[model samples]
Target: MDLVIKNGTIITATDTYKADIAVEDGKIIMIGKNITQTEGAKLVDASGKYVLPGAIDAHTHLEMPFGGTTSADSYEAGTRAAACGGVTTVFDFVIQRKGQGLIEAVEGRRTICDPQACVDYSFHTAITDLTPEILEEMKESVEYGVPSFKLFMVYKKEGLMVDDGVLAKALEKSKDIGALIAVHAENPDLIDMRIEKFLSEGKTSAWYHYLSRPEFVEAEANKRAIHWAKAFDAPLYIVHLANKEGLEEVTKARNEGYEIYAETCPQYLHFTNEVYKREDGRNFVCSPPIKGKESQEALWKGILNGSIQTVATDHCPFQSYEKDWGKDDFTKIPNGCMGIENLYPYMLSEANKGRISFNKVVEVCSTNVAKIFGCAPQKGTIAAGSDADIVIYDPNKKFVVSKENMHSDVDHTIWEGIELKGYPVMTFSRGKLVYKDGQFLGTPGHGQFIKCKGRK
Candidate 1:
């Protein structure tokens, strides 16, 4: 045995049981009751603690470029933060900016991250154009193991927003290639109209950003995406779903047997649109900005009831100097916030407050993401023969979130000054200790690029 975690309550989506997990050569060799400790194995006393599979942040923007600036975290920094927070894997989006070939954008992003990441990583191509050439490249990219694609309905003038016909063509192509399509579901026309009206009225506050992109915008786009998915018989994933109405669309589509999946980010679950009312509200500006308090409650209900399938960080980081870039106009500001390191701590605080069960946290943050992104049974669960990616959690541990403790290059935390309970004490990637007790043990370029199985 290389390493053994003993005397912990192993929690999964389906079971909570006591067991000792043995790791040998980066694979889970055995998990059972009262396993004898091997002579030379490294041992961890997980007494009175919980062991869960490492979380997989399925949606994150590392080294992402937006609003004339790039996100502060490079692949190495972002993944390092992820490891410290107990996330062992990440599926970051490779942006295909307008006019660029999809393959070229993917390649460029790969070059930036290939030698930088510290944990297992994969990519989902953001499809900003659906030209015949780009769509053809989509099929080829799928063969290289990037099986998922994303389109934005809100970045109409800047990114991919197909009319009914283009959506049909893209979905049809995806069907033939066994790929999944994810959409940033916001109605751009409506948002632009409202934004123009607000600006004309001199209402350029950060709070107005939420008012301009209302829940109905997301709901309307979600319903349309669902219909398109059904029409083309293609599986679809809706990213960063913000409100109750959008969840209704996903639930209704699933009830009608459409292969539709939706993910909501941590900001939506914990913060409200009122966060934008602060003097420093610009720090919280993200696309589909945090909605009303009622919407936050509804999203939690959706998570508990199964309407929302995954909980991801949507970890887009920007520097504090850039946070005030929208002072003159909210629309001019970049839309994103930092959360790669806060995902687990924030979720655990929710659990401590009785908002969600501990097991449900693992389900949304770990299990469902793995299953949805085609890495299940290997990356998401603590079963035999699976990769030994694991985390030891201290539920009673408490810490205050501050910039000094964060691994991101960004200057401030969105949840700064917030107290948090329960954090990862140790993190392991494939039987190797990557993070432990506030120290990062992994080396640069140690993480391997994983080719995701195409969505079936």
Candidate 2:
């Protein structure tokens, strides 16, 4: 099949130019001035639009079970929503629950996603259990194309947090295999102690939860993780860093030439700890919960200064009814929020407000993510020979985020009622017109499993 997207201002992290992109057999065959179209080719009139590489959401949780309830969006619904929002790729986590082997956990998550996703996907194995056998399997798993591993520093008793020794050993192993170690940075002992104190004092609301695990807990953990990474000379990825202090730690590490990179989510950039005090504050409940206004502004500065490499949604979806699951006792609340479909729009809105540049938007949302994840130049830019994953975005369009317009199966939107300018009007995945103008045309199983190149 041949497709032509013409007359758009094509934006990449490096350059903006007027060009026509021609795709044939799911690859960019031509990209230049006034590319002539063949007979029977599909033509996309992209005049007055911005054509850029499709966004890549590096963090997402689909159908993940946490705190007694599963996230509402299955891989099918979540990736469909991602595609509709112009994200052509996702690097989702494969959970390693307690007592499950690392390989089994990887396979289980793969089973859930293999036949369902509508966009290309890759996996980052979450190592919640540290056993000799499981540790031994890490090299093999990395060999099998799952090159990055994540360990959490929270949920002490659950199948989430890893003790310091386990984390150290995992980092040592990852270094040997050249795999990246991603961390969910929070001081679990501090958080648990505070939570116990709060519960004993009869303070058990969503607001109390935010107070229990304060920004200091995250900041302390961030510094500690960086220390460990430096000690072992291990490459590290700090996921969903929510505060300024944490970004400062990341900046310090980068300045010292440490192989450390961090990602921040939209929740931290836009929402403050004040959300917890709202009547529906449980909707924003997440681990290392959003902090005060000062932190929010600092996080925006982190994005502008390049201390934070990428902006991901950390898209975790659950129903509003599940908000009760976190009621009365914040400890029972699941830790996540949904925003995969809103990522680019939110960043674009920031650009429209002059908070950031359009080139920076492409860098954070697409290019930088691809570079950190080892898919750079191939999936993150609209250059010749790259995958023809492109989006035609209308910068003047404005819309409010509501559950009624969302493509995910979740019953609530964390960003509901927020007005935003700019949206993707058309999305192409590897030369195929998968989403356009309120419709999805991709088939199931069209998404291929991408084998990521590990840390070099």
Per model, how many backbone clashes are there? 0, 0
**Runs off by more than 4 Å, candidate 1:** 97-103
In candidate 2, what are the lDDT values of residues 1-456, reduced to their tens digit?
389999999999889899999998877878898889899999998999999899999999888877788888889899999988889999898888778877677777777788998998888889887889888888777777788899988876775888889889998988888788999999888888899899999998899989988889999999999999999989999999998888898999999998899999888888899999998888899877999998899888888898989999889877888877878888877878999999988887888778898889999999998888777677899887889999999988888888888788988898989998888888898888889876888876778787777775
TM-score (C-alpha) between model 1 and the true structure: 0.96
What lDDT would each prediction earn against the true structure? Answer: 0.86, 0.87
* Root-mean-square deviation per candidate: 1.5, 1.4
Q: Can you give the lDDT of residue 369 in candidate 2? A: 87
The CA root-mean-square deviation of candidate 1, after full C-alpha superposition on the true structure, stands at 1.5
> After superposing candidate 2, which stretches have Cα over 4 Å from the reference?
98-101
Listed in order, each prediction's TM-score against the native is 0.96, 0.97
Best by lDDT: 2
